[model samples]
Target: MAYSYEPHHFEDFSVGQTFESVGRTVTESDFVLHSAFSGDWTELHTNRHYADEEYFGERVAHGPMTFVLATGFVYRCGFLERTVLAFLGMNYMDIPAPVRTNDTVSLDMEVVGKKELSSREDSGLVTIDTEMTNQENETVFSGDMKFLIKRRD
Candidate 1:
């Protein structure tokens, strides 16, 4: 039987709360698939030999692709379900280090703040800071995302 989890309501979220998602690894196929789907043919992403000669010493995973995968991990771990209404936008998105193929990555989220929209009684905005780290424990990317969430009341 497929287990059904009751989604968290906005009221359940509080400042200082932290959530973590399962880890995932970047694979060559993932890189290829993402590159193909997005039409991003930058040498650093699609040309391994060229990348090895110019920079990264080898083909590197696309930055946006890495972010997408990390976001999927978060969703799989149940961070965005009934509690989340709409994804607003991202802030301070930074890809400080290149994610390489086979690099294991995970997501960490911290609830930085929350506010009840005066105009909406049933929903509010929650701002959280998210960080993606590699197996070697280096932060490859970081950002803040705001989501509209339903209030429990």
Candidate 2:
């Protein structure tokens, strides 16, 4: 089945709401482009030979790269398309495993909290717990994201 791509308002979300995204493989080009764009050509992310001597045993994708990709994956799910007013921030971000080339990744998101804003009647805050997992179902990145969502009322 195809994704819904429907935008959801604040009132449409609940504490137990969840979403899953389609898989996207991490590629060598992703590494190269992200390294160039982020100006983070660290040896661990750019040099295979150097990374081989390190604990991870091979070059790994940058933490920020994985985070960005996770956000993109969630975006593709389309629940926040036009109803999201702003991205407040993230909390307690953690990377539990390395993301290597050819590792297919997907995102799982669940709404953990929702609060109406006293200062703004048009929007409310929604907190989502996000996990980005690789093909092996190992969580490579995880965090809580807060967004200001437009209320239908």
Candidate 3:
């Protein structure tokens, strides 16, 4: 059954319940704009000559750029629209691989933990295991994100 978009109470998420988001392809324009916006002039992100010799044969996307993309994908999945009160923070983030141009990246998430906020009865904390994978099914990014989720009475 499709998960409803209604506000999911703190009890809605199970420790292993997982959800997935639609995929988005990385385009040349994504790289160009990201590079310019963040001023990440690293050779791996720009400068083709440096990348061709030092790393992958061609320019690669910035690691942080991929991070942002993953976050956006998760939002598109449902959490943000359904139950999110606010984005608390993320922890143990790692980008173990590069995301190259034309790669279709998708988002997946699992509810890793849940905790009632003693100070807030209207909401609670949900810890999610978030991952971003490329078209080749290689994991490019992984991390834990905590969200303030509304409680349903």
Give the best candidate by TM-score. Answer: 2
- lDDT for residue 59 in candidate 3, whole number 0-100: 85
Off by over 4 Å in 2: 1-3
lDDT of each: 0.82, 0.91, 0.84
My TM-score estimates for the predictions, one after another, are 0.90, 0.95, 0.87
Displacement of the residue 70 alpha carbon in candidate 2, Å? 1.1
Worst 10 residues of 2 by lDDT: 1-10
**62 in model 2: Cα distance from truth in Å?**
0.5
Model 3 is weakest, by summed lDDT over 10 consecutive residues, at 1-10
Number of clashes found in candidate 2: 0
Across residues 1-153, which tens digit of lDDT does each residue of candidate 1 receive? 222234667888889988887678889899889988999989888887889897679988888897787677656766568678888888779988989999999888888989889998989998888899999999998988888988876
Off by over 4 Å in 3: 1-9
The local lDDT score (0 to 100) that residue 116 gets in candidate 3 is: 88
Q: For candidate 1, give the lDDT.
A: 0.82
Clashes by residue pair, model 3: none
Candidate 3 local lDDT, 7-117, one digit each (tens):
356778879988887788999899889988998777777777888887578888887898899888777766567678888889789998899989999878888999988
The residue-level lDDT of candidate 1 at 123 comes to: 94
TM-score of 1: 0.90
